[model samples]
Target: MPAYEIDGYDNLIAGMVQPIVTQSIIINQATDAKFERGTVLARTGFTEEGMWVCTIVNSEATPAEEKVPVGVLADEEVDATTAQQRATAYVSGEFNRDALIFGGTDTIATHEAALNAAKIYTKRVVK
Candidate 1:
């Protein structure tokens, strides 16, 4: 399992925070192994019951790498893939528009500054 950290701003103001994750996600593979604590995730879209399924966010270029982080997964356990109350919301915190997160996959083609975008310290995926 890969582990990602929630770096950058820790002392975020209450208003800048948003609910990027949902509580209790029902997924196709419900072993619960995919939901590692602190791993960033994306949605598997909406279900018939209007629930958004959660999965590990995959990198576009690397595929095995992380993607635009929606938020961090809280430590949990559930066995059913298509289960109710199987997920918890991992929220996002951005202090301002300049807020940096360490998981962005975009790169500039031309010359760029070291701090071209908001940056957060990220721990790479361990295969």
Candidate 2:
């Protein structure tokens, strides 16, 4: 996995000190691996932001038994031209969108890098 570094900022009012801290780790993916509702996807080096917005995209048919309790999934099966296409899609459910934030002090370049990393780290489906 490819890795990168990001500089995070924190401010101290008492000391009047603004410190830039570096966070190093492997890239994060925008797309997540396909899993059933009950599946427990491991949370590894994902940062607080990552964990906040982290979601599993279902790329396959959901079993009736695996349905989420919150009435998220509308259908058991998603339509795809081929199995390959289907595997790239996310599951039908109410994903956690609370992770999104607006108007932060972070630089636009920094945010762009993070977004790009997500694309690179996306999970792949096997035929």
| Candidate with best lDDT | 1
- lDDT of candidates 1 onward, in order: 0.40, 0.23
Candidate 2 global Cα RMSD: 18.0
The number of clashing residue pairs in each candidate reads 4, 5
For each candidate, what TM-score against the reference? 0.42, 0.17
**On a 0 to 1 TM-score scale, where does candidate 2 land against the true structure?**
0.17
> What value does the lDDT take at residue 15 in candidate 1?
39
Q: Whose TM-score is greatest here?
A: 1
Clashes of 2: 5
On residues 6-117, what C-alpha lDDT tens digit does candidate 1 reach at each position? 3664322223233332355554564543443544455556787887665655445254323444444554433344454455544443222122222345332210222223
